[model samples]
Target: MTMTSAMPDGRAERASTKSFYLIAWRWHFYAGLYVAPFLLVLALTGLMMLWTSVLSGRDGEKYYTVTPAQTQVAVSAQADAALAAIPNGKVVQYIAPRTEEGAAIFRVNNGDASSMVAVDPYNGTVLGSWDRRNGLYDLANKIHGTLMIGDLGDRLIEVAAGFGIVLIVTGLYLWWPREGKGFGSVLVPQFAARGRQLWKSLHVTVGFYISLILMIFLVSGLSWAGIWGDKFTQAWSTFPAAKWDNVPLSDATHASMNHGGVKEVPWTLEQTSMPMSGSDAGKMGIAEGQPVNLDGIVAFARSIGFNNRFQLGFPADDSGVWTLSRDTMSNDSANPLSDRTVHIDQYTGKVLADVGFSDYGVPGKAMAVGIAFHEGDMGVWNIVLVTVFCLSIIFMSVSGMVMWWKRRPAGASRLMAPAVPGDMKLWKTGAIIMLAVSLLFPLTGAVLLTVIALDYLIVRRVKPLKRALS
Candidate 1:
């Protein structure tokens, strides 16, 4: 009797395990089908932007590098030169040179278009000019973020990224060894296997190796998405405007300063209310009677620890404040910990609000660091590491498609998706998982539910549709 009981229990356990594997595989297959194309575009565009940034500097700013000189011209002179280059233009922001030999950059707005003017800091000579949004880096970034189609593209990318998280979870579950296979079989691709088996091995191993990094990429990338990141996560993670200490606020937020599709401010401050100028509510900043001009603001920026590379934003109007900022995402500094933004009263030159990395909330801090890593801004090592990781992503995507193709029967009219086990009885667990995913990622959860509903209500009842789907 004892021997018979043990035999039945072992068989039951094996059956349950197989059922779960089939469930995981089915979900993984569907998620991969939807996410692979998006992943390919994201990885390729990411690589293009990365190399462009590393080689030519952010937004092609390296095109204006200059030789160092003993004496330097005034900040006002540089702004004047930039404004002169673009007639009828107004200087919106000034970017200090990163190195002694680097040229200063000025953002000038003429009508609806924006231009970047590179100037020699030594003699205030106008080096050259380029459209801010027309550069290769900006163009690639446009596609990378929104696919260059605006809000609709943003929503699609957001959904893809949301589903990508699901893909990672299911892929990991599928990769977990259950056959008592040795570690080598899981980590190393089986060279002896041929055709579909070899491709499967490569896909599994590559997926396993890049899983962690891919997760980081997905979460960080999602934090920039429109619905989830901007509306949900970022809304709560941003630095509180209440911390500005009773300063009057403008209608605009710090994000308003981010012009021409370029991110000029740190993520944590993007949604925070911009403090209006002309108030006596700020602490003493520029010395009494100092002219609140470009030169004065630049000096004040240096006095408060902003050095080498930082942005000095002009007041938008009578109510706007001068913004001094530096962050890794903007290529202002390599250290995310050094991220800082200060708003100064335009008339009084008083510091209105000073926000640093330490002031950011938990989510804000994580995103700040995550974005630095995501953008490969830490150093040369970061760039190399990210490049390899991107290549791995591309390989995994291609390998997955190749495996699907090989597994597909010749002249098959159906998609050949993984079949769900008929004996599976894990609805309760699946429901809970879906609930958790819905709460965490609304867009992805909705897509999963829609697919489930369609499969049950339409595909299951229609013979042709069921055959095509399964």
Candidate 2:
């Protein structure tokens, strides 16, 4: 008969582990108590980002810009035509889609407000259009972008983001390896620890794996919210807009855009100096002979053969030009403009800003790449990453709430629980972790310091409220 060997007991291992965990548990509880309200807000905001695509089908790229048929027309020409088409209209703003199939919109206001026309740049035909912000898509954009909070909503989002950053900093300290723990204790779950022991590992272990990604996504979300978002994009691009000496601000034919009654002409820098009859560049804008043909301009754009998905803006000035903006995600190097942009002088038939992916330096490249990533526009791979991030947040939130509930004794979870230190080593280890965590999340960190101080002052000196909070 074979003598079966009795496996060694993990008694010493279990004792040390219990000591470490109980210490980790209470301050962790304290940190959570201070941060949970903020975390709940994040959960809701994150959910909005996750579901934006479904917010409304308005972003579905079905919009268009209309003009005289050729291949392209100056967006200015189309705007002028549109203004003529509807009297007493004002140009609100415009957007050129980054795809050949993409539509350009000229937001115009009448007695109330509405889209005066949706133009199909491909054929210069007026496609479907509507007036007013009553569309389901518009509503979705507002809700997703602003949370119906408008400007105040933005500040709140930013504050929550700051809190998130703090949480990440603290969570990292909590995860720092202590003593001689191996990979299993750090990276994977330990099945044997009971009550909150099992859960502390679960919360921490899961966060350990996903923390880097969580920070990226949250920070990126902040960047998407305000004026900084736009500035960030421009800085990260390869092509900086050409700066000109600030002469007396050139008198823009801007009046034509705001009001429809004026005769429309090609917009250019020279035209801004004086009336066309009075100046040379102004003369170049409108012919004594006739306004330049739209078909000719459109054909010029198609001739250059940029990729199909670009938004084309017509000249807003007297240039009779078309501006093509393409969204290009860079493959290597820094230029944000890499693989982005196309401009055609419809008159001189010259390409102005023919930027490729190499144009943006470090920042531009990073920015374009990030926006594409956040929108799930980079490709299938990014979508997978985004999906995983979303699911992780949901899991963390749910499991966290459950774990908090489970660890409490019956009737002890009235949002107040007494700390009974039956174990000193455990409490000591927990304090050390809390001290480390405070280094990152200063707010939560400050609270932890207060508690230890209390344990010194009141809790040790007296001990009633300390029992309540801990």
Candidate 3:
């Protein structure tokens, strides 16, 4: 009697395991079907940007390489040269070169148009100029960030990223070893397997190997998404204006400087208010009787330890403060630890507010580090690792599609998604988990709800549609 009861119990356990596996597989299918295309695009564009950055440096850096000289030209003279190069334009910002042998870059604005002029710091000669944000790297950045369709594209990518998290979670569950499967099968691919089994093994092995890094990519990428990143996460993680020592705030935030799909400031300070310049309420900075001009600001920046590769933003208006910013996100510095931003009073030349990585809150700090990793700015090893990771993603995406195609029956009209199980008592738990994900990522949640509604109200009742979609 005991042996007979044991046999029934074992059978019941196997059935339950099979039921849950089927459910997990269905969710994995749903996520992969939606996320694969976006993953491909992201991987390709990311590779393009990374290789370009590593191979050629920033867009116009090649033309700006110069020989180091004993005596450097004045900052004002460099600005004059930049403006002279781009006739009838106002110098909006000055970028100190990464090395003594590199030329200073001046961002000159002519009405609606803007350009970057590379001027030699040694003799203040105009080396070359190019339209700002017109490089291939910048174009690839727009496509990667927002698909180049603006706000709508941003929202869609956010949804895809949300689903990407779902894909990773479900993929892990599906890959988890069952009762008879050994640990070796989980980690290493079984080349001995043939047909669909071989493809499945490759897909599972690669997916499992890259799961953690892929999740990091998704979360960091989502931090820049419009709804989840801008509206929610960024709003919460923004550096506090209260830390600015009661300085008068401007209507514009630090994000205003981030135009044309480029990040010019640190992520932690992007949403924080910019300090106004007119107020005389700050520490002594540029010294008395020294005019707060480009030359004075440059010297002050140097005095404050802002040496190579820092940006000096000109005052936008009478109330605008001169901004000194350096961060890995903007490729200003190689070290993420040294990320800093300082606002100086345009009239008084006093340092109004200064923020660094240490000043950021917990979330702000995490994002700062994460952004550096995401952009491959840490070092040469970082670039190599990220490149390999990107290639892995592309491989996983293609392999997943091939696996699905191989599994589907020939001439099948339906999508052939994993079959829904009968007597599935665990569905309610799955629903709750999905609901939580929906709450966390509202855009993805909306898409899930819409699909459920369509499936229940339309697809389930219509016979032809049911066959086509199931």
Clashes of 3: 0
The C-alpha RMSD of each candidate to the native structure, in angstroms, is 2.3, 10.4, 2.3
- On lDDT, the candidate that comes out on top is 3
Candidate 1 global TM-score? 0.96
Q: Compare candidates 1 and 2 on TM-score and give the better one.
A: 1
Query: Once superposed on the true structure, which residue ranges of model 1 sit more than 4 Å away at CA?
Result: 1-7
Ranking by lDDT: 3, 1, 2
- Give the per-residue lDDT digits (tens) of candidate 3, residues 129-221: 999888878889999998989999888888888888888878888898877898799799999999989989988998999999898888888
Tens-digit lDDT track of model 2 for 1-470: 21112323565455556555545544455545544554555555544543543332233334433333446666667666666556788664445445455565566667666564666655455565565455554454355455577776655454445445556655666677766876678688877888777877887788888888777765565454453332332324323334222212234422233222111111111122211111222112222343334444334444555434434445545543444444522111122343444444445444444444455556545655665565455555665677776667766766667777876678772454424444354566555654664444333345456656867878656556655555
> For model 2, what is the error of residue 424's alpha carbon versus the real structure, in angstroms, after optimal superposition?
14
Backbone collisions counted per model: 0, 45, 0
Give, for candidate 3, the lowest lDDT window spanning 10 residues. 1-10
**Candidate 1 collision pairs:** none
Q: For model 1, what is the C-alpha lDDT against the true structure? A: 0.86
lDDT of the candidates, in the order given? 0.86, 0.50, 0.87
